[model samples]
Target: MLKLMKLPTAWGLRNASPFNLKAEALLTMSGQAYESIEALPNKGPKGKLPALIDGEQVIGDSSLIQRHLEDKYEARFDDGLSEVELADAVAYRRMAEEWLYFINLWVRWIECPTITRDAFFSGIPWPLRGLVFGRLQKDVKRTLHGQGLGRHTREEIYGFGEEALAAIAARIGSGPFFFGDTPRSVDAALYPQLLNVAEAPYDTPLREAARKHAVLTDYVRRCDQTIFAAREDLPNVA
Candidate 1:
């Protein structure tokens, strides 16, 4: 049996981090028998969550986990996609992970800090919560700054997010999935992040921007019902 170490669920989603959801999506899509355990990033080899424990081997990062599944387990998430479609999928996945992710970080941690801080650090004792949360916020801001999106104004950042959502909506346009009717690896990469922005309990412009795209919200439901449905049966998911 395989074990997945991931962060706790939040906002009615499988995991707080979209990357964790991506890794689990890959596992479920691969039809592997696995159990999920709640864990912090430090437990992973690369100081990240969603580490797959296969016997003595610990696989870190979702992309590497996908490779492990493909090579070792013969799982093919994009079996039917054409080369062009595959390339498009890669581009969209990069947009979601790299570009839109920083926008989300700014909105959640900087714009709506109180709500996010409460949600993530509520378990910590009051005396140390401020200290711990301050450090976490600083680290996240530093990461966003390094990504360059944090350098932009809030309005500009939200504008970028709206543009990204509009682009995704234009591409999808009443689709059963990203590329086609089939759910591919890119769907695993994308669905969770979009869902987090659209459904998470925040009222920031980023969430508003995501809400503007009816196609995307519908797509999230479609993925939840089809691609991610199997995950609900997993033991101790939260």
Candidate 2:
């Protein structure tokens, strides 16, 4: 059996960070079965999660993992998308990966403690919520500095996130997936970022706005049911 190293036990619906969710969803959609191992990069692999070990091959990072899976499974769409379509996909994926980071940072630093505490504690059934929260706070701070958003105020981050999301929504148009009919690479990539923002423990005004968006909310629900169901069943990480 192919084994996926990740924070979630299975590939689908795990409460993983966005990147992990994307990788798992892709795997699930491909009809591949993988065993998952909980990874704590901060404690073990230099602060990474969702690393995959398949036999003697060890891979880390979500983008690389997706590429690896695509190569091995050959399950990506082959219909020739126009250059414009391809470009739009790449652009959306980048925006999703980049802007969503700030959303997560905002949630961890500002919103998580308030809305997520009860949900997180009640879900975990473990006594390590404090430790998890502490680590998440530290990680978010580090990530913010790494992304050059450390100096920006929360208001700035929120504003930027709103703009980014609006841009994504505009690109989505009336397509069920990012690419209209069928899901493409970009759909797989961006969906997780949106999912993270919408489902995070924080229910801030920004998150609530995302939730209110019909298309975005529907997309998250579909991914949760189809791609991430396995992860959702696991004990909450924190």
lDDT of 2 by residue, 18-43 (tens): 77767666766666677666665643
* Alpha carbon lDDT of each predicted model: 0.87, 0.67
Cα shift from native, residue 150, model 1 (Å):
1.0
Candidate 1 lDDT by residue in tens digits, 1-238: 9999888877777676899989888988899879888898899999987899999999999999999999999999988778898889989999998888778878888888988878888999987998998898999899988889889987899899999989888888878798778788998989888988998888988888888888999998898678767766665544
Alpha-carbon lDDT of model 1:
0.87
In TM-score terms, candidate 1 sits at 0.96
In model 1, what lDDT does residue 212 have? 84
* Model 1: residues with Cα > 4 Å off, grouped in runs: 232-234
What's the lDDT of the predicted structure labeled candidate 2? 0.67
TM-score between model 2 and native:
0.79
